[model samples]
Target: MASHRKTRQHPKALKAMTLALAGAAGATAFDGTGQAAPHPTPAQVKGRVDALYQEAEVATQHYNGAREEAGAARAELARLQDEAVRRTQKLNAAKAELGTMAGRQYRSGGVDPTVRLMMSADPQRYLDGATVLERAGSHQANAVAGYARRLGSVRQVRDRARTTAERLERSEAALKRQRVTIVRKLDAAEALLDRLTDEQRRQMSPGAGPAAAPEDPARSGAQAPSSRAARAVSFAYAALGKPYVWGATGPSAFDCSGLTQAAWKSGGVSLPRTTYTQIGSGPRIDRSELAPGDLVFFYSGISHVGLYIGDGKMIHAPHPGAPVRIAPVDEMPFAAATRPA
Candidate 1:
């Protein structure tokens, strides 16, 4: 399952507190306005956002480890399978050669009926020759069969090893995905948590109203793979409270793709609109070399994009009905990766 560190405070507890506070504040208001209430304090909102950022940080680490483990397991399985294949081929070839030699010996005109009759008086010699040939043939056949059987046994053991490796790979992959998902929750949780520090909350997003959000990013001055990814994530940090919109790229509102596009542009590269196009355009890369500004594809279809923030993390707009945020690279149900075009 996806890993997450739940807050000491529960959502129900927070709801109850909010209701109590709202009631108290409502009672104190003058003129029975029953009117518009004050928004939460900036400090409260900021606290929630901070919590999300911190959670993302922790989740990122877990995701990184999981991904590495899964990849290693898969590599091991591949190696074992390759060895098994070679062994099987060698065993088959040996068996086939033995079959050819045995077939030729049986099919050859070695027994002559006329010659057998002439050696009737010394039938013992004939019998001895036939027996010697039979024994020699049996020994040769047994040697070839034994070699083939031995190799087959070795192949069987290798196959078992391969199967075990595959199981391990799958488990590791699942673990990696789980950690990634929690990181997304960590991002969304910040939205609800935003109520804690209203001041910092406003800083998460900009509006005509007074400044209420925190400017200090959860991760500050992180050395990213590229200056472009860094700038993009920084811009995203400014969009903490924006509502998630479907397919909306933005100066204001944003969907996951939109947010990624805007952030990468900050670094000077222009990406395509959808995840599919972006994935097709970039250079393919193995996991070990992944860097910021490089587009990572999740679910194998390239439906997600994030600015690599280095250290196994990426700042991104995670999904529909979610906020822009930072998460581990292995997050987004990772399928594969690519460098920017």
Candidate 2:
């Protein structure tokens, strides 16, 4: 159920593709001297597949984070663009007003006050006109200054918009690359899975051990710190058996962070889209201090997350081919935990 926009091959199609690739995986490789390479044991294949799945999950997290950032950047860029347009309009209006002032002065024979006084038939009348001209000139000066400031503001907004636009472009490119990497890793992992027998595949699958409905936190002696936490824990339990979709956060499927975010949302606490960001969603807590509904992160990169459901166990989507299910909190490397209120 782990789906991506670009990769929508059904699970059955994926299985077939993997079986085809497994044939190639079993094919003997030739060295420069044409010697046959040794085939990998099922154990080695499982190790490689597990590593590939982890790598894919890391890439998926990066993609999710980049997507979140891109969304924000796009909104910021739009706001900056609107600001620039408004500033440009103001600058233009100032310019037009300054131009109109200059035109009026030209129509009135824009000559020096001293020359106008010398040529005037009535010198007192010309003096009065000069005072009015001086005031007009001051207004024009103010208009020019205002225009300069508006122009500067427009430039600043434009510069910021340009910078944000560039950042969005780079983030988009990175997301594309990360998407490709994830797809490739998932494909390879699936092929490796096909190389193993059903028993071997079950042995290597995530949440393969005793996956069942989680116990009630209150009854299991893992009391939630608050009603909100209890709601999140309950939401996670309801999501059990749903498929793991790399980019999905849904009623039917989810990725690791997606599951956590959705569960927390049901608790009335908004969480970020990726594990990296969710790590900072609330104050960090020690593993010993972990409570039901707390988010438990895994791996050094914080690429995976789970909703703690009490009794030292957590419910998570795990990896592809796994469903939303219960697993030990210590199943993977413990990176950190957070209690989002």
In model 2, what are the clashing residue pairs, if there are any? Answer: 2-245
What's the CA RMSD of model 2 in angstroms? 15.0
Could you estimate the TM-score for every candidate? 0.37, 0.77
Q: Write candidate 1's Cα lDDT for 49-167 as tens digits.
A: 54564445334434434555666677777777777777777767755765565556557955333233223466445344544444455555344445435555666768777677877
Q: So what's the TM-score on candidate 1? A: 0.37
| Candidate 1 wrongly placed segments (more than 4 Å) | 1-39, 108-142, 172-176, 189-341
- Most accurate candidate by lDDT: 2
lDDT of 2 by residue, 14-45 (tens): 99999988666565344423346766777798
Every candidate's lDDT = 0.60, 0.82
Question: Can you tell me which runs of candidate 2 are displaced by over 4 Å?
Answer: 1-41, 111-137, 206-211, 214-218
lDDT score, candidate 1, position 299? 59
Candidate 1 yields a Cα-based lDDT of: 0.60
